[model samples]
Structure formats: structure tokens, C-alpha cells
Target: MIRKWAMRAVIAYFLFGTAMYVYLFFIADTAIPQMYKGTSADPATFLNARELMLSEEYSNIRNLLFFLNKPYQWLFYYLILLFGISAAFERWAKKTSKWFSLQTLIYLFWLSLASFIVTFPFAYTSYLFSKTYQISTQVFSSWMRDQLIDFWVGYATMAVVVLVIYMMMRKYKKRWWLAVWVLSIPFSIFMMFIQPVVIDPLYNDFYPLQNKQLETKILSLADEADIPAEHVYEVDMSTKTNALNAYVTGVGSNSRIVLWDTTLERLDDEEVLFIMAHEMGHYVEKHIYKGIAGYILLTFAGLWITAKLMDLWVNKRGKIWKVEGTANISSLPAFLLITSVLLFAASPLTNWVSRYQETRADQYALEMTEDPAAGVRTFQDLTRAGLSQVNPPYLVKIFRYGHPTMLERINMAEEFKQQVSEE
Candidate 1:
């Protein structure tokens, strides 16, 4: 009976995803708003006919993948539980280790390996699509190496998270969710603090901005913004892709303004400064700290809800699933399945907050640089370099867009230009 239900759910999910993709790709109106039809903000104003077509195709494909990935992940976990694979993993782990933590690690390694294998196709397909679109410059061997690194890093991180959660469960019992939530606050911050110095360098080399003259200008901008930034670092991204990006990352002493080498290579000094100012905006506005706070609050609520759901599910179906209770090591997939659904459901809220912050940064950049022309041109160049859609489908904008759409950004810059002219 459970197998039959799983099959039906999978079919329904696939069909619904297919229908949504078809509608968005073929039927949705992805054109720039009528208000900008002949204005400079029109995508056609910057992108040629071929570029526009490619951007739409690329964006649609990306959206399709984004929509499908989460549900597929949920399905994977569901199948693992239904087939008793997770329970079997538990048995194997117990046989291998008398210690609970060691047994947990053994079980997790097998589970993580299976997940890695299952998800590799999605990652490869994304790479293939990017390669086809001339967006990826990476060779197959380099890409595979990166994939291996990602898998191990992911497994290690998951190991820590699962160990902590399971340890809390063993000690706190029904109150484990509260304990895990408390610990997660510092864990999240530590990850952010170390990510710039520890995790990031494993994939690419980072060095102080080689262009001293450009770095001086950026530092001057940072000073004006009251940001305590001392150095700007550039990463070697040219070997991987043609995409251009810049960002603010880390917290406190680890805080950094990082520019992709592609951004420096492709953009002029004034444009790069505007981008720097935008990143500085993030620091000055304290978006990172605020983001952490928001995450902590959301997780507090989510974990509480998850505990309730886990209890309800385990009490009702734990026997048939070959699970003893919520505290069982075999219940990790079930826990993940619940959290994944909650995360997906919460995406719109998170994305909206992110977009709001991005918009403020754009505004801050314009005000600080007082170079609206450079801002507009920089955005246009970004769209061209990345093959991004100026205006994406509404649902895509809600679920996937952390930054404002290209059309909105260009319009903001143009408005800034107009306001300065009046002044």
C-alpha cells in the first residue's frame, strides 16, 4: 500500500512539474513591461536578437532545474525510508561500531554516498547546459574534481550537523529540537566566519587585488561608506566561467570584499567602483548580521514545527517504515524530508528579504558613486556577460531571484540619473 502511494505521488509530482515548466517556457509572457518598451531599460536595447533568445532559453532551463531539484530530493528521501534502506544502513553501522557516534558516522557515510550518486546527474546536466550556452569555460576533468571536493565537504558538514542533532536527541529526548536550535545559532556563525578563510580557498585561489590603482579607489569608497574594509581580494574565476560577480562575505575580521577576476577583466574602472560600492553597501547596512538573525528565528520556528510533525508521523507510521522512533538514526532522512519541504515553502519570504537588501545596495551604490551612468552600464554588462533575463516569469522571480530583475535594476539606475540631473 505504501509503495503504491509513493508511485502515485511521484507521478503526480512529475506531471505537475512538467506542466509548470511547459507553461513558463512556452506560454508565459516574459517580455519587458510595456512601460519600458522603447526605453533604454528594454532588454533589446542592450542585448541583440540572438543574445535575447539565448538568455530566455538559458533562464528557462535554469528555472526548470531549480523547480525540479527540491522535489526530486524529497522523493529520494521518501524512497529511502519506504524501501527500508535507511534502516538497513543503521544495522550495518551498528555492526561496524559499538560506539554511537562512530556508528552514526558510518551510517551517514553510506547515506551521503548514495545521495551524492543520485544527485550527480543533476549537477552534470547543469554543467552540460552551461557549456552548451557558452557560459562555462571549465573542462570536464576540472569540473569532476570540483564535484568530488563538493561531495566531501558536504559530507563532512552533514556529519557535524547530524551528530549534533542526534546527540541532542539522545540527551534531551522530546526537547531535542530546542537544544539543537540553541546550538545552531553559534554553528551558523562559525560556518560563516570560517567559510572565507577555510572552505572557499579549497576550490580557488584568492589573493589581494592585483590592480593596486583600482584597489585604492575601492578603499576610498569604503572609507566614505564608513566600512572598515582594508583590502579587496580577487578570485581566479576565469578558468571556470565567463560570468562576472562581486560580493561582500564573512563577518568581523574575516569580512571581505571579493571581486571575480572576470569582473575586473570585463569592466572598466568606474564600473568596478560602482560594483565595489554595492558590496560595501552590504557591509555598511549590516545585512550579514541581520541575515543571521533572520535565519535563527526562522529555524527556531521550523524546528519546533518539524518536531511536532515528526512525532505525528512516527507515532502513526514508524512501525511500517521500520523506524523505532524519532530518536532513531534511521530517522535522518525523515527529518531532512520535513526540513526540505519547509525550506522550499519558505523560499519566497527569504528571497523577498534578499531582493529588498539588494535593491537598497543598488540605491546606496548610486548615492555613493554619484555615477548613475556607470551603474546602468555595469548592470547592462552583467546581463550580457551572464545571459540573464531582464524580466523573468513572475513565479521564477518569487522563488529564484535573490536580486532584483535586470529591468528593475536598470530602471533604478536610470531614475537615479534623472534625479541627479534635476539636482
Candidate 2:
């Protein structure tokens, strides 16, 4: 019965995904709006023929991967449950230790290792594609090292979360999800606070911006915007990728305005200032705090729904897929599967919120800098450097994009210019 349901779900998921992919990629009208057709916002004016071709191919591949990844993960979890691997791992962990926490850790280790191995092919393929398109500059060894770091860090984080959730489940039983949700609020804030100071330094070297002149200029902009930024840090991104980016991260004293070295290397001072102004907008507008609030609210609802679904599933298929209930360490895969599905379903809404915030930041940058020309040039350079699509299909924007399309950004800059001219 479980196998039959799984097969049917898989078929339906793929069929729907394929239909959407065909409509969005091949049938959707992705042309630039008529208002911006002949203006500087037009992509053809900035991107060369080869760049246009590459951007299209790159965007298509990325969109295809986005569509396939979730279903592939769901299938993986389903197969593990069907084949009794999760239950077997639980049994093995029990044999290793009498301590419950130890058993949980052991089970998590096996699960994490298995997941890493299973997903490595996808990760490597993504790297290969990026390398092919000149998006990634890191050598194979460096990439593998980063992948290992990611896996171990992820495993550790998962261990902590699973331990907490199971502890709540064991103690509270019926109201465990509520207890976990309450605890997650502070835990999430703490993680965000420490991430910039601790976790980020592990991946790349971050230091004060090397060009003192540029740093002074960025700091001046931050001051003008009342951003409370003391320093502009630079990360060594050229060692890993050619992408240009800048952002404000952390909260309170840990707050940082970080610029990728590639951004400084590729863009002129004025363009870089526009980027800095944009990041400062995120900070000054309190987007991070708002984002955390939104996350906490969503997690509260998501956990409540997940708990209900887990209860229903365990009642019906507990003996078939596992040896015990939700509190069982073995049920981790089931918990993950439910959460993953919810997150995927929530992508469109989350992306829309993110895009809205990003658009606001762009407007703030324009208002603060009052340099629409620099904003336009900055966005154009970003598109060229990243080979990003200027006008992706509606579905792609809805599901995947967290920022406005390139054309939209350029058009906004042009409009800002016109507004300033009239004033």
C-alpha cells in the first residue's frame, strides 16, 4: 500500500513539475516590458550576444535543477523509510550505547553520512556546471573541502535540533511541538547573532576593506544613512567565485558591512558605494529583525502542522515504516520529509517577501545616494559578472528569485533618474 502511494505521488509530482517547466521555459512570454524596450534598461544594450546566450542557458539549467531537487529529496526519504534503513539505523545505534543522547547522536551520524553520500552527486554536478559557466573559480580540492565542511556543520546543527525536539517530545508528549517552537525563537536569534562573528570566519578570510579610501567612502555613506556601521569588511571571494556581492549581516555589535573582494575589483568606487548604500538600506530599514519575526511565525505554524501530520502518519504506518512513534530517534527521516515538503510549498510566498524587501532596499539606495547613473551601472555590471537573466519567466521569479529581475532593477534606476531630473 505504501509503495503504491509512493509511486502515485511520484508520478503526479513529476507530471505537474514537467508541465510547469514546459510552460514557463518554452511557452511563457519573458520579453521585457514595452516601456523599457528601447531604454537603457534593455538587456541587449548592455549584455553582448554571447553573454545573452550564456545567461539564458545558465538560468534554464538552474531552473531545471530547482524543479528536480525537491522531488529527488522526497524520493530519497521515501525509499529510506520503505527499505527500513531508518529503523535499522536506530537499532544499530541502540546496540552501541545505553545512553539515549548517545544513541540519538549515533543514529544522526549514520543518517547524516548516508544523506551526504547520496547527495554528493548533485552537489558535484552543480559545481561542475558553475565551473563550466565560469561562475566558480575554486579548484576541485577546495570545493571538496568546502563540501565536507558544509556536511559536518549541517550534521552538527541537525544533531542539536533533533536532540532538542526529541527531548521536548519525551517530556511534553502531546505538546512537544509547541515547546520546541518556543525554544526555537531564542535559539534562532542566538545563531544569527553568532553566525557573523563565529561561523562565517571558518569559511573565508574577512578583514577590514584593504583599500582604505574606499572603506572611508563606504563608512561615510553608512554614516549619512545613520547605519551605525564602523567598518566595511572585505571577504576573499575571488578565490572561490567570480561573483560580485555585498551585504550587511549580524545584529547589534556583531553587525558588519561586508563586501566581496570581487565586487571591489570589478566595480568602480561610485558603483560600489551604490551597492553599499543598498546593503545599508537592509540594515537601516530593520529587515533582519522583521525577517526573524516572520521566520518565528512561520515555524510556529509549520511545526504545528508537522506535528499533526506526523501523528496521522504514525498512527497509520508506524509499523510499516518504523519501530515506534514520533519520539523515536528513528523517526528523524519522517520529520525531515514533512518539513522539507512544507518548505518547498512555502517557497513562492517566502520569495515574494524577499523580493519585496530587496526592491525596497533598491529604492532606499537610490534615495540615499541620489546617483541613479551609478545604480544603473552597478546593476548592469552585476548582471554581466554573474550572467544573470534580466527577465526570467514569471514562475521562476515566483518560486526561485529573491530579488527583482535585472531588467526591473535597471528600469527602477532609470525611473529614479527621471524623478530626480523632474525635482
- List TM-scores for all candidates, in order: 0.99, 0.97
228-317 in candidate 1: lDDT tens per residue?
777999999999999999988888899888999999999999999999989888888889999999999999999999999998987888
Q: lDDT value for candidate 1?
A: 0.92
Mark the regions of model 2 whose C-alpha exceeds 4 Å error after superposition: 1-6, 9-17
Candidate 1: minimum summed lDDT over ten consecutive residues — where? 24-33
Mark the regions of model 1 whose C-alpha exceeds 4 Å error after superposition: none
Give the alpha carbon lDDT tens digit for every residue of 185-270 in model 2.
99999888988998898789999988999888888888888777777899999989998999878877998889999999999999
Candidate 2, pairs of clashing residues:
none
Question: C-alpha displacement of 77 in model 2, angstroms?
Answer: 1.3
